[model samples]
Target: MGERLAGTVADAREAAPAAPAVLRVIIDAKRFPALGEAPPRHVLGPLRLTLRAHEVLVVTGPSGCGKTTLLNLVAGLDDELDGRIERPGQGRLAYVFQEPRLLPWRTVAQNLALVLPAGPDRAARIAKALAEVGLAEAATTYASRLSLGMARRVALARAFVVEPDLLLLDEPFASLDRATAQRLRLLLLDLLETRRAAALFVTHDLEEAVMLGDRLVVLTASPASVATELPIALDPAARRDEAAVAARTAELRGALRDLGSLP
Candidate 1:
């Protein structure tokens, strides 16, 4: 009986489909042009990374390590760099910046509607997204009136409303208070689990990276490259455990310190 069960499990594993590759980034080099008397600033590369569907890859590095530049490259906001980014088909990409980046004059629902296509179901989509982020009643509220935490929630709602294939988060929870940030992190985890979208999240917080990433990539100092890539084995429930998260964070920090990537 035990042998039969083991064979069944192995067969199931073999039958399961592999996760599709969602994004491929190959950057041979990235440099900022010289200004007047200064030389060109070498910022990043010789970096290659892949993001797969239903995966969250968090990138952590020292300050001024060109992390944001990498995001810009992936988003196609800057195409002058040495390498190329490849994505399967024309998939929608959503981004949540450090700042809310909402239009102060527009209501929360209107802000979301801007990204969504004009359709009869747009209102429903907006409402559902707002509710998912715990902001149901704030749909009609103007972005200018929201507190910092609330505004960040709206930003998240806006991102998810589009049903993106890939999500890019750049320190989305950075400036919030501890409690608020924790709440947002939980909310984000729930959304990611439900949506199963690929994500590339960037942050300096080691704990946040440990709690949220399916895999974590550590980068070097200026002209950043991959220092190490650590696959997180923690389940979703384990991520919510403060002690577990802290231990993982410490371990990651130690590895980075050993490599001289972190101080």
Candidate 2:
């Protein structure tokens, strides 16, 4: 009788459906129309990618390879592309652009509040997000007064406060000093650990890519397409080790070299 019951349970599990992808991108092509003396330019070739829940997919490639354009397309900021973007269900999304892009006139708390709907719990939510990013004391600080690093932290807090299902980050660490950038990266990893949201990150830094990405998507030059997809299997704890990260970076560079996509 026990054996029969076990067989029935196994059969039920086998019959269950698999979960759908959080997002799927199938971009056939993207082009810019002629302007004055400039002729039409193709920015992206056929490309396909998918994002699964709690995954961090980093997109990196040569300069002018349409990495930003790809992110914009996935974020639904562009509709001129040839193919379609499939998001399975109605889910909240957030974007942290290259620049902090905070309104200088607003306070840090106010900045986070803009993304959230007004309610009695709004203030508490803002406080919790700020605290997670180590900016609890900066709640009332004006965006204009905070330094670049602080501003980036505030932007990150804003993205997380809404509890997005998908988070899109475009070079969030660009232009910061190494120490500051490292700090922010670590903070981001910690937050993602707790939140477990699917993230699509774009960056030019190989080291940063090696440290944060679960999978790296390398693209070809202008009129970009997928050159290769490299899965990074380094243990999460190893991401902090210089030797581990350097080894992985070297491996990635070699892969790019083989594809002739190295920048």
Candidate 3:
């Protein structure tokens, strides 16, 4: 198992291209309209960051700290903010939101087929993605009929099927049960091992950040900005072990506590 994992990591390193920048964010400032009869409130600003190829950057901060807002800007979902975001012009992007956001009326396979381009092997691709997430048997099942965990798996499959250049995840496992979340996390790690993409995952869970991130970027309470950036030096295989995860989690917690951001 160890040798296999080492080989996988090596393959990933080789597959990853030498890109100067996959994503860049330069935010001079950001603000939002306040409640009725109030002035605009600051949200986030004066921040600059870059994501390289095949990197997983995790963002963690208190609730309402503009984490989602930052992702929106990167995804080009929101242009009402004060920021300049850059992404590779020819790159494809995929996003996994907190909610599964699947088409309830469609079957699992049909939902995945929506984003995939028409091709001779489209069906095969869909099947393979479902198998990856342990949902091959659920392909014909209606998305609305599946449990929350299954639904999330389908969502993940949809994202991976597109084979995006930049992947954005906004608390994809936020409301899942502990066991389900852990399983999905492993699935995510496995998928990332084979797929080379720059990913930005936003979550409030410190443990999740330490487990999934190449580097963790802690943000301020509100009007979020980078607080501290910590590189996770553990090997990908070691990070899966309980002891290693615990140690890394503790280290991240201490860092957050010192910044007064740990809840």
Best by TM-score: 1
Residue-wise C-alpha lDDT for candidate 3, range 1-263, written one tens digit per residue: 99999999999999986766889899988787787899888889777889988899988888898888888888888877676898856488999987899999999999999999899999999999999999989999998899999999999999999998889999999889999999999899888878987899998887887788888888887877888888975688876887888898998788778977673
C-alpha displacement of 225 in model 3, angstroms? 0.8
lDDT tens string, model 1, 101-212? 9999999999999999999999999999999998999989999999999999999999999999999999999889999999999999999989988999998888888888
Q: Top lDDT: which candidate number? A: 1
lDDT (Cα atoms) of all candidates against the true structure: 0.91, 0.90, 0.87
Q: What is the lDDT of residue 131 in candidate 1?
A: 97
- Provide TM-scores for the models: 0.91, 0.90, 0.88
The 10-residue segment with the lowest total lDDT in model 3: 81-90
Name the 10 consecutive residues with the lowest summed lDDT in model 2. 14-23
lDDT of candidate model 1 versus the reference? 0.91
Candidate 2, after superposition: displacement of residue 12 in Å? 13
Clashing pairs in 3: 43-223
Clashes of each: 0, 0, 1
User: Candidate 2's residue-wise lDDT over 146-245, tens digit each?
Assistant: 9999999999999999999899999999999999999999899888888988899999888888888888898888899998888986777888787899
